[model samples]
Target: MTQAENERRGNVPPSNKRYFYRTYGLTIASQLELPELPKAEATSQPDVVVLTPGVAEKLEGATFRKGWLEMGDDRCQITIEGVARYRVEDGQRILLDRRVPREVDPVADPGDIRLFLLGSALGGLLHQRHWLPLHVSALKTPSGVWAFTGHSGAGKSTIGAWLHYTQNWPLVTDDVAVIKPHEDIPYLHPGPPRVKLWKDALAALGIQTEGLVRDLTREDKYHLMLNKGFQDHPSPLKALVMLERAEEGEAASLERIRGVEAFKSVMATLYRPEMGTEFNTAEQLMRESIKLAGKIRVYRFRRPWSLDQMNSSIEPLLHEIKQ
Candidate 1:
């Protein structure tokens, strides 16, 4: 798009001071550059544009959904009620508006709200754009990328952080892994290099939190930016591991899942999956899931929630992957 066109679309105050960023296989141009993301070389035509709040006129019947998100055919709005509101349109533009209360601490950083948008709000945008976003954290192995996925508090990020810190593996992405099937092989795109972990996970990994920053939404969780051993490029997806908590008598074990069971597990990890229904991506994702199940090995990884059990399970998991 051109400068005049951007202004007409409610992308405000177009200036030459554009910050370009690449993540999840798309280029973004914005005025306020995110410190957490690596900068991309300047691009003339960006895939997504970010602007200050201007385009959002109240949609008459928009009601808040389960995750404080509302969506229509071509647009979505995220409202943090008293904190901020964001609208993404046509999967191409995002506009943010903040609503801080008078009682908030004066020293509180406003950037935290933007970071929140970058998480769930950005995932909504990717879903609208028809990208398959998985609730996964991945590591780079000599074979390829191995993705660990499960429900919240299933230790995906914790395991990813542990592997990166102790095993010297590169973290490909944290929280969301945007994937695409190319030439019969699924590829995992790189996201932000930082891994978010709870305080308990940090303690288990022997990480000091003296200088760490807490997650904006979850105070107990913190962010750890991987300065070294961070992968910025997409890699072929080699394996999928579905993390599950071990039952009382169960020991930590990795077992293969096949056919329909593998497909169901992969489907469960998709980010903001409800939005995929509105965008008609369910069938597409289903096809991709089946193809992935057929081509790659999938495993059910069970472990007790203790740090010692988690540590012990790693070697066996690695051995299974080697086979």
Candidate 2:
């Protein structure tokens, strides 16, 4: 029967058993089985609950309305054209509305939905819960968790993939670094045990992408799931390494950032800084940023852009972390 007919006859039933998963230090019970996240033990009370697909209601009294997004005091609605509409409320609940006409099979067709679920929706929820999410890929070392933050194509994931695959360092998270603020030291929560690597990166790392899952948005990028070497718990954040492209043929250097420059650099790494402004006060963000800057050491690492220098580029960071 057609999907439309199934819907019309009320034959598309939601899953009877909710799936429990964990990421970024939160337990989630989701109607959809998200294989991208690590499975968690069943819990009666989860930190977040993801409901089944349903009609999305208009956010009442939305204070911020822009292209494809609406935000209120405690709720956010994100409409991705031709994909799905998501509602994240009070940092606890998430509701999905499928925009595509395909059959409702969460397991088989969860790539696109899971992408946004872990991206914009989760980012919004984190902001609401007062956690700082930075755009970084992290790996756990003997000292502590080291996070790499930089612009796109700055080799964050490539470096991370190299270390995880070659050096046996456990990957903490990829793409988004979740920070739980504290007085003495902030903590970094582990995210999904996957790294999205471009084709060239995979080749550079001597990895075969035959069975790897392709990224939904990037045609040339594939998701590499680390089943073995993955940090699955929260760890005290050690340092922030900011990667920058150095002049061709110039030697790589690592230097410490201090005072105002450190604070500004940390602020620049915020994964959705606008969400912080919308869901939280400027004073709140400032306070957290200041706390993070004061507590953590931020290092600026400049390296040549060539792939040949990838190993040499990581040397400076590895040496610095050992100190």
Find the candidate with the highest TM-score and give its number: 2
My TM-score estimates for the predictions, one after another, are: 0.88, 0.91
Poorest stretch of ten by lDDT in candidate 2: 100-109
lDDT of 1 by residue, 153-252 (tens): 8989988888878778889988787876554558888777788999988898888989888876788999877756889888888888999998877778
Candidate 1 overall Cα lDDT vs. reference? Answer: 0.76
In candidate 2, what are the lDDT values of residues 1-323, reduced to their tens digit? 76543532335866667999999989999987788888999999999999756745567788988887899888889876656678989999988776444354432345766788888999999988988998888988878888888888787898788877777888998888688875356888877778999999889888899998888778999987776788888888888888899997788899999998888888888888888889888898888888898888899999888787788877887888788
What C-alpha lDDT values do all the predictions have?
0.76, 0.82
